[model samples]
Target: MKFAKYGSITLITFVLVAGIAIPLSPSPQNWLQFPVIPGLEEKARNILYHVPVAWTTVVAFLVSTYYGFRYLKTRDIDYDIKSVSAAGLGFLFCFLATVTGALWAKFNWGSFWNWDPRETSIFVLLLIYGAYFALRSALETEEKRATLSAVYSMIAGITVPFFIFVMPRIMTGLHPGAKEVADPAAISKAQAIADSAIAVGSKTFADSALATVAQMNVGSAVPVVQLKMSPNMLVIFLLGLLGFTLLFIWLLNVRVRLARMEYERSTHHE
Candidate 1:
């Protein structure tokens, strides 16, 4: 539909903010300070967009695996291709998610790789998905490869989420929401403030100063600070996102066309 163009524009904007702008913009000096008016801070800013990127990629992978299973059942080569595309996209996002999370951790937790439960789980997910790609390559026959890969995908799918969500809570780790230090309430509240600010704008120098002052005042002089976006950075992020999205769409269309051509050739030969 006509919406595709609009969608491309929106994604480009996001890519600009995430990839280029945020990094160039000034990071909050003290990211951990809680904002008084229920919204403000830098860590919260990262969570707003970075977490979602990671999440979208994870869902993409899962959906790919689902299609892989379907391809095995229906013997549809298209489904197999689609499944691979989704998984490939998923892996890209998962890797991005881990990198972004590492950036967040470095700022908040004082280290990039801490072997925390959350980190470990995601790392394992990366490994398992990597294995999925490896398994696909090891087989020679198209049908056999599809069947075996589908089975492997299903098994990995079942295990990855369990490991990502459930195992972390049960075990001790430095990640947030772990045993003996669970504090979703505080984290959620802080996150809410950050999200609200990011929705309006990113934190600016002035906003940062005001937030710092408000933090020192201890509620007596709480100020309402609005998020500010760097126009240049925003533009750059949008451009990068646009470039990637266009490439993805173009590749998908080309693949579909090739498949159609192959089918027509087979029919003509028959």
Candidate 2:
């Protein structure tokens, strides 16, 4: 158990250092030089930590919702506890991701709140999950609450993919890759031809061909620049993630033990 706890802390530290700190820092050349999209310079740095956190939280919530469903099916309190714990952690990470994204947006798009489709959708997701917790608390009976919450969680989970991917693309938004808009130079001649084949109206074959040629010329004229990372911030972020992970694991273990003891006492009384 001690080793498991320590290992989880170490892994979390590594993830934070590699994922967040190193990417955010501004100096010490030896760290990896991450590639940025052509026009977005320092702003691209947001991709490293922000994207990871958003996706990680999505995964965490999905797992939590899955356990919620399982609890309903089996009437298992353990599953319910696990579901809530994971959801709580997921919520923290989701909020962090949104804040980081907001910072990036302020720098890149000149506003923190743009009501972009992707941003609005994710914000809605946060609200929905927030309501989930509140609804859980409003009920008096644990079993009834868990079952109903599980059903709601499952329904919400069904919309996750749509909100995360599809909804963002259907509208014009400040978010990247929406509607599959790509720099023509990023595609090969053959790929460009393929893209043109299906292109129509404003998105016509002639337009695509012209855009492709223009993109290639522009790209060739510009030189790529890489960003460097600072060591101190990297270490601090690593330590923070490590500390948080260790604390979480310790709390989880304590919760599990307490639940077990409560069950035993209840059994003895019966």
Candidate 3:
């Protein structure tokens, strides 16, 4: 446990330094080069910090749900404690991801609250977990509380994939990998096709746009596609991911131990 704790601290320090120090791909004077992203430029560097935290949030929730399920099967209060603890941490990371995403949006899109489908999905997720805590507080009996909370967490788990994956692709939004192929080159090609269609009056602009998109292989799947990172950026991102994962493990260990102590104390007094 100590090894995990200290290892996480060490790796997180490395992540912070490398993430901040690595040079982003520079804007080219000509078309032969691409900035990490055409419009995002240096702000694209947020991928290092933002994506890892977001990934961690999903991981945290999944782990929490796993423990919740375990509690259902074993009727172990310890699992219940773990479920809540993991969910608590997941909420924190989700908040961080949202804040970082908003900052990234403000930098790239000139607005902090565009209500993009991805953004809306996260908001709804927050509310879902928020209710988990509320329901937890409202109940007084230990066994009943554990059982119901476990069930509720499972129900909430159903939405996790939908919010993070499904909803974003189905709605047009400003976030990268959303429903739109907003890449500069793709957009330009789409526009040219639309214009030519309008001039010839042989096809609808929408039809021309769809044809261009199909020709370019642009689709909802493309927006949510993974960003292709340069070798250096990829290494740093992987290190950050490793560091955060270790941190989550260390935190879970600590929380579970504390919960065990509390549970023992309460039982002893009873």
Candidate 4:
């Protein structure tokens, strides 16, 4: 927990400093600058924050599922505390992801909401988790609430991967990793740059750091989504991913402790 606390702050500070201060150039002369990927340009810096937050959202939800399973197996109220705390954190991060994505979309595509495949999927996820909280509140019995939501959490968690990873890829709509990129030629030069970077021993830092920034189609009035990143961006992106993940851990721990304190206070009164 202590490591998560200090490490997150340190890494996130580096990400922010490097992500913002580093200049974007059409032709980066050295490692100090980032080559401007076509179409994205300066706007691509948003990835340092937005993508990591969305990644944390997925992690929180999965952690909630794990604790929910533990509660089911052990019938321990503490596990329930952990499960619900994680769910709350997941919901918070999910909303943050949605807001940040919408803001990016507004700048890139001329609208706040395009219902892009990934956008649509994330919206549905919000609704699903929102319903989970509603169901928990409707029940007064602690045991029943925990048991029912544990089952619900597991079921909801099962669909998360499908919504986030599988469905987006299988569809023909926007977002990278999809079957089609919508406009390839417009980004051919950028893709070539990215490929060459990878060929020179650089790797796609994170296959899914929580997707963001889709390549715009040159031919269409509307837009499609894809990514073309330089190695410089990848370095900060990786740091951001790790920082946000550790931040989630610290937050989850604090939330669980607070919940337990509240539960203990109530138990003492009753």
Candidate 5:
């Protein structure tokens, strides 16, 4: 287990750098052919890193909640400790994701804070988990703390999907997959760009494609920018996802061990 944890960490680090360092396209100027998203351009590189971190946060929270549920059923202190450790790491990853996302927003949206639906939802999620720690801290007895924390984690789990995925998609936001974006016209436009970018190799194809979209005097107030990643981009994205997932697993293992040690020491002193 130890070898797997540390060995994977070294391998993942190399893979992550490779994903980030490799240019989006074989031809730098013709990045449009390689999954350089229409509006995002160079900024799309963040997608490789930012998205995986967000996903890891979700996985961590889910694991935390599962352990919390187990603790409730078994009344085991170890399960409670494991739950807290997972949650603590989850919150850390969530904060990192938010920070990276905000930086991306600063470049993409021209502001550090935009109150975008996705951003708002993530903030609310932070508060929900933040309250989890606060509630744990307030309790004096072990049983009370464990029971209430487990209950709160279970409740928070229910809101995870709603906040992270559902609510953001329901309301029109900068995120993809919104109501307006799902329209037929947007899909066709995205397909056209992809087909053109692949068939014709030149900067002009991208410029003309974007120009056509701009000229289309759309009826909607908000512009619909579809994200179409190329095959090369998809490969990098998958590598990043794999690396981040392994990193999360390694970190979670280390964190749980440390938490167990701390719990043992505290109880020993008491």
Candidate 6:
């Protein structure tokens, strides 16, 4: 627990200072120099915060679903509490991902909300979980609330992967991996193979999910994070992912504990 707490803080703080304070340069004389990419430029800093937060959102939601399954199997209210607590953290991280992404979009695309496919899918996810809490509050019976919410969490969890990972890459949008990267060097070699399909004059990625665009790597399992960046940037990005994931676990533990105390207190009133 202390390891997660201190490690996350140290890693995140180091990433923040490095991401913000380090200067971008065209010529790299040392490891501290960051070569500037044309399309991303300063906007690339958001990757440190945005992608990791989005990843954490997926982790939290899946954990919630796992707890939901546990509750269903054991019929334990404690599992129910864990499920709901995880969902709450998922929502918070989801919201943060959205805000950070919007900030990236505003500078890069000239708008905060462009209704990109990824953005739309994430918004839909928010609504889905928003309804989960609503459904919970509408039920007064403890058992009934737990049962229905558990079922809903399971269903909602199925969409988390589809919405975050699948739909975003499959559909064309302004976000990374969805839209073509103006700078060819930023894309992976897999995208170069996709260029052959583009040579056939079939560049309409938005036409269908299977449509091939130069930057759209449909085969990539983690397309969103498949950024071909410098070694320095890659290290920072990986650290961000690790730090946020630890932070999520620590926060989830605390949230579950608080929810359990609340559950006990309310039941005692009965």
lDDT of 2 by residue, 1-270 (tens): 686577766765565555544443233355554433433445554554576567666766787888898897789888887777777777887798789989876554444665667788779778877988999999878687888888888888888788767876664444554444333433344244435444633334344344433444444333222223245434444554555545455555666677667857876998
List residue ranges in candidate 2 displaced over 4 A: 1-8, 11-32, 181-270
Instruction: Flag regions of model 4 displaced more than 4 Å.
Output: 181-226
Estimated TM-score for each candidate: 0.60, 0.63, 0.78, 0.82, 0.78, 0.80
22-114 per-residue lDDT for model 6 (tens digits): 889977677898877645667678888899998898788888889989999999999998899889998999999889888776555444775
Best model per TM-score: 4
Over the stretch 183-262, how does candidate 4's per-residue lDDT look in tens digits? Answer: 45434433444444445543431111112223333434333444667787888899899999999999999999999999
Candidate 1, clashing residue pairs?
Answer: 12-238, 13-238, 15-237, 16-237, 16-238, 39-193, 201-227, 202-228
Error of 2 at 23 (Å): 9.4
Off by over 4 Å in 1: 1-5, 11-40, 174-176, 180-270
* lDDT over C-alpha atoms for residue 244 of model 6: 96
Sorted on lDDT, highest at the top, how do the candidates line up? 4, 6, 3, 5, 2, 1
**Which tens-of-lDDT digit does each residue in 81-195 have in candidate 3?**
9998998888888899899998876544444666778789777767877888899999999989889988998998887788778876665565556666445555555566556
TM-score winner between candidates 2 and 4: 4
Output the lDDT of residue 27, model 2. Answer: 32
lDDT of 5 at 260: 91
The residue ranges of model 3 lying beyond 4 angstroms of the native Cα positions read 25-36, 181-226
Number of the candidate with higher lDDT, 2 or 6: 6
> In candidate 5, where is summed lDDT lowest over 10 consecutive residues?
210-219
Off by over 4 Å in 5: 26-33, 181-223
lDDT of 3: 0.74
Q: Per-residue lDDT for 254 in model 3?
A: 90
Q: What is candidate 1's lDDT per residue for 1-270, written digit by digit as tens?
A: 234445655665665455433432234333222232223334645644465556656666677788888997899887877777777766777798799998876544434665667788779878977998999999988788878888888987888767777887665454434544334443343344445555656554234433433442343222222334344434443455444455445444455566657757876997
Candidate 6 segments whose C-alpha is farther than 4 A from its true place: 164-166, 179-226
Clashing residue pairs in candidate 6 (N, C-alpha, C atoms within 3 angstroms): none
Candidate 6 weakest lDDT stretch, 10 residues: 205-214
